[model samples]
Target: MQRPAYLHASYRYGFWWLALVALGLLALGLGLRDPWPADEPRFALNSLEMLKTGHFWLPHRGGELYPDKPPIFMWATAASIAITGSVRLGFLLPSLIAALGTLALVTDLTNRLYGRRIALLSGIALLSTVQFALQAKTAQIDMLVTLWITLGAYGLMRHALLGPARGWWYLGCAAMGLGIITKGVGFLPLLMLPAWALLAWRGKATPLRLKELGLGLALILGVAALWVVPMALITTFGDEPGMAAYRDNILFKQTGKRLATAWHHVKPWHYYIVSVLPWAWLPLVLGLPWVVPSWWHRLRRLDARVLLPLSGTLLVVVFFSLSPGKRGVYMLPTSPLLVLAMAPLLPGLLCKRGLHWLATGLLALLGAIFLVAGVLGAAGLPALTELAAKYDVTPWVWWMLLGVAAAGLLVWLRPRRGMLGLAAWLAVFWALWSTFGYQQLDQTRSPRDMMQRVVQITGPSAWLAQPDFDEEFLLQAQQPSVHFGFHTDQDAQFLRAFDWLTQAPGERWMLIPQRKEDQIACADLSQVNDLGLQNNEHWWLIPGTAFASCQGDASAAPLFVAPTTVADAATAGYQPATQQDQDGVTATPEDSGK
Candidate 1:
């Protein structure tokens, strides 16, 4: 078979070019987009809070203890922010480094295990995997945890391949310890046990002295102790409620409690098998059937290198699957192992006539589907409209159709490297989507613009308060005008806010939930604007209160008409039809106090 154009590019210009392209694509939109709600903003806020408080040992959010995760990610993000001073750039670097570093590690490992061709292929495959790419760009702890797990796994593999004299065991354990502090399941690298056992059963064991193994265990504990011991000592001795919650949640609820009975993300045993691996592993999933059988044939020989990846992959999958609390990102550590398992088979598979046909056909089908949907969606077909509406499908999505069309054309024109071409095409598609399309979507979902509108209406001299506001609003706004009050069961919270609004000597603006409008209505505060956030949540803003005159005319229509952003049309979440302000209030010209 003739070498494919992409492979030829790799052979001639060197595959580092491909790696650079992949990393560059991953880094494309890092500085442009605002922090997304739910996870992104929360993580970013925690890091920012850490930076503000100068309390590096414990992570807090909005003046409260945050124990859902350890402080490693926050520490890293805070350090990045301290140095770079750009929230987007700072919060993004850790994940980017982890992702590119993982790719480099995979390349190095594969090159050692197989050869240059397979190493390049493995790096490309792992980099372009849908979940891996998405997680790398996200400001979450998953990618950081993945990095530590990958390092730990590589260290163990080195020991297995070379010998105990190398101390790869200790290095691997230390990485796993770092992973644990980064995320709770850092010890997942220990899944190598089953892999080592498989090899031993096949008489391929690399015997290690008991002392060395003990030392590795100690290293893991020692790394964990650097944080755990300090946190425990301080929180145990201190009477601070937040610190206590942090200790309890981090040590138990986030780990043991989650394992025993997770409150969120509860899924059935087959969740990973059904929902995660199939999609998360994507192009690799398509190749697994061929790869698995080939590995199975070699199982009896139990080459340490082959057994290491196969067993580690199976163990991680099964372990996460058994947990009732499962998320796709939890299994990120398996990406490299899957890449390793598939590398030996890739050369032959790349040259296979049948695989080439499969690649071309799949790409063509996907392209045709995208083309039809894009045309229909553009043509205002109700079915597609409803579907597009359900996903906040942006006008920019037409670009994806172009991408799909290009991918299809490339594969058809160069069938010899259809798989590689398709992977490269998808990577470019994702990069472009994240770079441009993401901002378009974010403009609607994120409250950054909405808050800016609030600041505009209220002006800099005015004082603004959001009682029990989400961190996204605060972080994105970044204005001293904003004041936060803790949400609680007490009615005094509302009374205090109303009293403040009614008695404040100057203009006092507040963002309140629409549902609570009745509670503060007696204050006679006039509604200025509103914002619709994710999950059917809506907030209303009252301009200022000094006059006892109550704009109690509750029937006023919305003064500000929210343009139908693409998100409003696409999201399944309820979009209020009234000419509502972004804060979810209907304002009339009469009520605008003009």
Candidate 2:
């Protein structure tokens, strides 16, 4: 089959237009600051190895195969490294591109299916979304995974509904498979593809056979196997011992690891519900009564466009709800769906009284919240102080405060504006503070900063320790010529592996943030040379005598902040239960438009 000229031409040049725009915005969001983490620094180091060593299959750094995620981000980043010779820039640029790809996908797909106005708004909303904004630029694979999933969803739907372009269907399958490899099991969105195709084809019996779909799946699986099979085989040769452990981490444990549930980050299913409220505010929050009204109108007139978004909203929330663990940002992928489901139908959704309320009353409500929070922040400092004792006032809380004020201003300026007002306000709020303010509030910067700092002080052989991926700063700072934390040791990841926390500090070395603050086995802070500082937080964190000889436990004072006592982690809004390996119970999801 000779490919048609128009389709190829339209996409070849046109796709880049969208991609370029997405790329530009991505760069804007990430700016010049280093990556932030729980996950990003490790991702950065993984790619750095792919660059430094020129090995694609086995991701090793300092000396170990890294495991938190598969190699898609690393491969993408590594490719960048080959061209630019800069590891951080290489890894970051691709993820930024991928993240932008998502917005482009959202805009074009929705625009083709719906209209340009709705498509534009949805894309902007997705890009501007609080969580999406942060994740897309942070050099983590989750955004890439999200990009793959979203693109796959768009491709899958277009193939199933618009018409069967076998190529498009195959691409959908391929994208999904990559998505699976990118983050494990997220490829399951493919399961819904056929049913959607059926629905799109108006229930027509057709030649879109399971067998052909099987081939497409095979193609995706094959690409994945190329990477997996080699890594698996080479791992047995002692090239990648962690591969076996990672296989378990990826395949069974992440989903099934419940034996004593080594981690304690689990939270109640209501976690997202409570978390989203602050971002959503009274208009959306108190607008709960309106969900029935919105659902009722859609039901009255079976609108496919409205239903599509509603379906996405349901699937995203329901899928996560069923998961054993929860993070607020997990629901971020479906943010565009929320706007699509509700905002478009506003004119139709409002009955006489409802219209009046959506116009006048909602503004009034937001006004009240803005005034109240400000009054509370200024006047009720005592209550806030007490609350702060329980929960360190996280950056998100302040962001929410700023968002509420911005939302109020938007509403006051234009009550009938709908989501445009919401988007504008949120954008203003984040732009103002994300660079300077949020950075401070966030305790963990990506290990890039930490990595760079360590490089300045110590050469390759300085012994170091890392309790977790906290060494992101160190890696970002420079390539290791010698052994150090995050790469040197990952055993500190297990809460029980406290022994791994012990390390010898060299005269010139300091521990990466991930390393335990305790004394290194043979080194003393008293014996160390000062290396000046790392960006902001590292300035205050002076190295000390080895953990074995510390006057007080390091946890009492972390390398950066005045560390809290053991009683603090739980009482101070950090949920130990939130990290539980056990799955959270599923709750009945609230109706979509609501």
Candidate 3:
């Protein structure tokens, strides 16, 4: 069958229009929100610290050496912050540009292989996929890593097919090297393995000479060495012993430990196949089940298009599964190939009766979900209060129902436009969610409001000590807080830090979480003000005048007697009120939104 005329002719040019839509989707909420935790504030704070300390190679979190990641992504983020002068805007640019560049590369690659129409569609598929868009707007390294991996894949494809000989190999290997620095396992040659296997099967692997392969490997090592060499020199020979942790983490823990015995984000072996990929690459995977037979047939015949993506995707899934440390986003580098694998089946899917029914059912299901959410949000139901408490989303979030209804109508009236309609529908929801939902989400996630109250009460230069400190709160407050200790471990470091807090030059204000107030043995303490719940954790501002438990300071000087118990502590302007609405537990006066 001849390809559609529109696929060949219309898409031959003006494909960049799709890139604009992607940019808009990615940039919608880039600067409107403060960095939230779990990843954002960690990286953002690290970058901001780097900017302040002029230590570009070493990454720090809350003044402690943080070495879970390489510095290239943070360097880019720091540069962005430097240029933009806003942390929110600064940290988001690298991912946004990487996503846009990936889309451009995908379009070009698809155009070469499957014609311009499929190329454009693949780009659109990538843009609207929930995980891709979500990661692109985040301050994380996944999107940047994916960008390098995609470029490397493109280079490998060029070498296998229409390459200018050795340059393609060098280009691909160099890109992968950059990926390695961006993320620890960016060196996974998922693209190269499949491309090589297919070429070897067809007796066309001679284009990749052994001499060129060695050179490419050398280039990759050299590019990666740019940072690793300097970093190794500093950490090995520097005065800071804490940097040994950083060096060990970067060289071993970040990659090897994560693969073998991950300290965090561990999951079952089948997590990727059973949980992650099915939804992470959605819209592309929407009709995938119905098209698998066609893919299977193509694969059985050794079709390069199907084989390339199949082998690459299989290798990545297996490699990640072998590692106990699994995250959904870890599969992001293979997402472009997943999109590519599905792009060729679009025409078949458009005609498949099963797909038509499945798509319509999905559209109806989406409409129903939005309809219920809108009804609940508009009616101001109690059930939505929990969601609202967490997301801080407004009644305006339900406005997406209107867009959903419009999309349903479009699908009903013009069934042939179902795919485009579905893409538009998802795009509209994501945009609305990002724009309106993010506004409230930001307010709730941000500590700027609560930190401002602290500043107002204590003054800017007041000696502030947070034993169980939150980096996000500290970053947002822009306060160089005195770190007493961490909640997780109470080692000698904690004792020394606690002693420092107790014996500091002047009186200190301890910002203790209300739950931990009973744990501190401090005297002459008084309540200042309640800084409302952040991430559902309630904190109280307690001013400590005397250290009750200093190791050797029982008879040093006469300041005040330390309290023996929580009952002995004094409270000023303290009123405890329990409101059972925000969090599942009984909310304290802190729930007053103070």
Clashes in candidate 2: how many? 41
Query: What is the per-residue lDDT of model 2 for residues 282-317, given as tens digits with 9 covering 90 to 100?
Result: 234334466657767864564545555566666776
For model 1, residues 527-557, the per-residue Cα lDDT tens digits are 4465654424667767555325533221221
Candidate 3 TM-score, true structure as reference: 0.86
Model 3: colliding residue pairs? none
Note the Cα lDDT for every prediction shown.
0.69, 0.51, 0.68
Clashes of each: 14, 41, 0
What are the TM-scores, per candidate, against the unseen true structure? 0.84, 0.67, 0.86
lDDT of 3 by residue, 399-447 (tens): 6565466456665645544565666677777777666767667768877
Rank list by TM-score: 3, 1, 2
Query: What are the runs in model 2 whose C-alpha is more than 4 Å off?
Result: 1-26, 29-31, 81-91, 191-208, 237-243, 254-264, 274-309, 336-412, 438-469, 476-594
Q: After superposition, which runs of candidate 3 have C-alpha atoms over 4 Å from their true positions?
A: 1-9, 204-207, 390-415, 484-488, 491-498, 504-506, 521-528, 546-594
